[model samples]
Target chain A: MEKDHKPSSTEKPVLQKVAKLFLYTFLIVIAVVQVLPLVWLFLFSLKNNQEVFNLPPLALPQDPQWGNYARVWTEGNIGQYFFNSVYITASAVILTVIFASFVTFAITRMKWKLSSLVLGMFMVGLMIPVHSTLIPLFNFFLNVNLMDHPLAIILTYTAFNMPITIMILLGFYYTLPRDIEEAAIMDGCSVHRLFFQITLPMTAPVVATTAIINMIYNWNEYVFVNTFISSDKFKTLTVGIQNFIGQYQTDWGAIGATLMISILPILIAFFILSNRIVEGITAGSIKG
Target chain B: MNKVMSDKKVIALYVLPAFLLLMLLVYIPIVLTGYYGLMKWDGIGSMEFIGLENYRNLIVDSAFWRSARHSLLLAIFSVISLIGYLLVSLVLSGRIKGADLFRKVYLIPMLLSSVAIAQLWMRIYHPTNGVMNRLLTSIGIEQPPLWLADTNIVLYSIFIPIIWQYAGFYILIYYAALRNVPNELVESARIDGASPWQIGYKIKLPLIAGVIKVTIVLAVVGSLKYFDLIWVMTQGGPNGASEVIASYMYKQAFTTYNFGYGSAVGFFLLILCLIITYIIRKLTATKEEVQY
Candidate 1:
């Protein structure tokens, strides 16, 4: 029935208010659920073993012990691991942009014969799940003495992160208008300089998206961190935190404490780039 | 011929570095993972060839089938809830003021590490004095099941956080697609006396079927490879109640160090992913590209 559609006046206001009430209440509940684990994480972080497992779980600390963070930092070497993650993640992001931007230029501007072929090959990597590749990559790393080396994961992360990065930059660079590019070409800018100056600046938003997304992946990564990196110094937060879960016995309080500390970057990133991050993920997936 | 040759080389020059890197990390390993299926290697010693034995045994391995079933179940539940919730969220996004805030709350979990999210869910599902059970009892329920610990509910329990975490991504997808629909169509519907719900179901949904189709496909693919959450929450445990294919394969390769068996499962995963994605690609894609 293509009966022409319209909003009925009588029910509209009532429905709108009811919807508003439901939505506000729902948001309040979601906000609580969203933040509650964090609250539990912080609360447990301060409690001793007795209080952690206490019935009616300790809502707040009777005694606020500041030592758990220290233990996780010193004994856990979370500080060292944090630095290692930052170092590796920084290198990986830089490498990803360098390689991906070059490829994007070749495909979009250089009129390379293998442009489509190159993209097709990288696209294949996206379909093959990580489980299939882990063992061989592990052996390759082992044979090369990259076992527990941050560089090993950095190399692989650059490769694994490429598929999505190329997907993004390819789309972004392709969509760029041609007259400005021709004008730049007339100005004696080389292909490389064109990318860095005119073309690159134009794609700044996408570059930000790619870099932030890659940083997040490298920060929270577990399987690669656990597999290739064995030593304490090399262990990132996810792997380092797992140490608290085992060997002698699990320490719930310390585990919670470490978890609270671990999510700080994500929280800060969310606070700053919440809209951009959501938009990036959706745009990359839906369009690219 | 020279012109064509130079053109090809230029393309090669551009894509070669990225392409070669992928070959090392992705292609060779996948080939090896498949190749190892025929050889019984313990990952430390000489690889002895026993072609198809892993697959033969896998056929009889009840645990493998059980894990596959769980993966399939998780896939179904996640796809249904994720798509359903995202659509509802999209609709609410239309009507609700302060939608940006709701979306932010939803997306916080997605930004954090999967391990962090898992640990969060573990607390949510805690047996005694967990937030979930506490909420239940406060609302007049006497019984509270140990969520991650209980075998039956464990798989579904694992899905809750995943669905919650990922719903935001899908909402963004639908929202973007909704935005692209010409305002005239929506305004016209309003002028023609259709209810908001009617306008959505009739005009909006079918219009964005392509995006919805994609959301479905991604949901399926993402769920199949789902491991991080399952590994963190329950290492396919409490009697292997929540074993996805990836986690089960992980236990073999890393935990038990059975490289050959793990490789065989990895091949199976490859084939499964191919079949699923191929079917989806075929279904969603039209012969002629739809240009807006």
Candidate 2:
């Protein structure tokens, strides 16, 4: 009798089960919508124009054209653009992280009269649209003879990204205990040594977060490079791929291959450090 | 402690490099943009003093106003879509399996560059051979509208990919906010015979109002200045159907060599962003917020 009286009865469980199935279906459909285009892109990257139009969108090509990737890489100045993107991305990330680190440290750790004002400037810098500065920057770069130069792109990236990088680092810096600094000062450590040997290492995790975020931004950056760098040798993948696709308008496979190559690094990074990427993006944007 | 931490030289050494760069690149250029608007200069030529002529012209410029209207429409669409994102986050924040994996998958597009997304979507909308047309035709539709070519539908078409790119971001924010709602509040509410719908609407939504407000501001401002993807996909083509303020500014300064006019647009954009940001912040502030 007691067993029959249980609240976990047959009817309620069945109803809830159906609801759960419906909910899961809804979630899965959205996931598919988000991913389907990229899957289609990958599918066609291996097919010639004939297979692309003749076969179903999802069907695999009978003979995969692996040479599409090789041809574009060798013939389209992509190799040069790839390295340019790499070193420039690396340079900007390193410089922005370190420079932003220095500023964040001084603002949070060191005592200064104008610290808050200086920090306010960087924070306000966040809201200034990049386009507003483009004309003047173009003129400035041209005047300085830095137009079409990689350093122009690299330095501009560093300055623009500093605010958000510092913003992310600022939170982590504030949360750190003062005991380390007190101990370091007692041991006769100078400011530079204390920062390099202690504070910087301690903030490694957040640094890594900022570094990845900066890398993504720099690697994918188009406008500054598009506006400032005119020569192909200095162009990054984002801009280079634009020009490449223009020339290969009819070659769907090559265009697909080029797009794939442009995005592969970011995809790989996300695979490894997805949690950090998610955390960094959230910390950076939500705070604003 | 003050003596050790307040060294002027150390502070200057640390702060000046980044600060100067910000001034030179970010701050100074903004001021110069406004000043540059007062002159008539081709990008390569000397300036002629034009005073308020460009600004006056902009007041009546139908092309500029049309672009502004398109941007405003995008902003409205973005704000509306936030509701759908909120609903998804609410569902995911429930007792579900594989939520983490699903959110990560949704973020894949966000990770790729706008250029890549643009190039990929161009093919996906490739009128005849595109996946969209193929699917429609397979399902026995005799005709499907040309997406990017039709000016009437083109803006809305572009909005789809923009929504796709940003859904995960807003969902992730809402999901995080929802997760922070205390479980005890939810459990007690449930024990009191409140339905899931009631709890979600009354309890969960109110608790996350602050985050919702932030996302509203972000979405609206982001749409107002959107450029990269639009530039690549349509180049504001099919008769400037999808042009936004940033792209218009680009076309003027870079393409048409109308530096003075472009600078006017750029200055207007800067002021517009700041003013809108301030207005939104003021409007969204609740009475409870004022107490602090």
TM-scores, all models, native as reference: 0.91, 0.97
Please list the residue runs of candidate 2 whose C-alpha ends up more than 4 Å from where it truly belongs after superposition: A1-10, B289-292
TM-scores, chain A, per candidate: 0.88, 0.96
True contacts kept of each: 0.64, 0.80
Candidate 2 CAPRI level: medium
* Tens-digit lDDT track of model 1 for B1-292: 2233235655565567777788888888888888998989999999999989999999999999999988888778866776566555656546566677766776677777888788767876877656788778878988888888888888888887887788666766777777677788988888877777788889877777777777777778788888888898899998889998999899999999999999899889888987888898788885554322
Best-matching candidate per lDDT: 2
Off by over 4 Å in 1: A1-12, A46-67, A247-252, B1-13, B134-143, B286-292
Candidate 2 chain A, run of 10 with poorest lDDT: A1-10
**Native-vs-model 1 lDDT?**
0.78
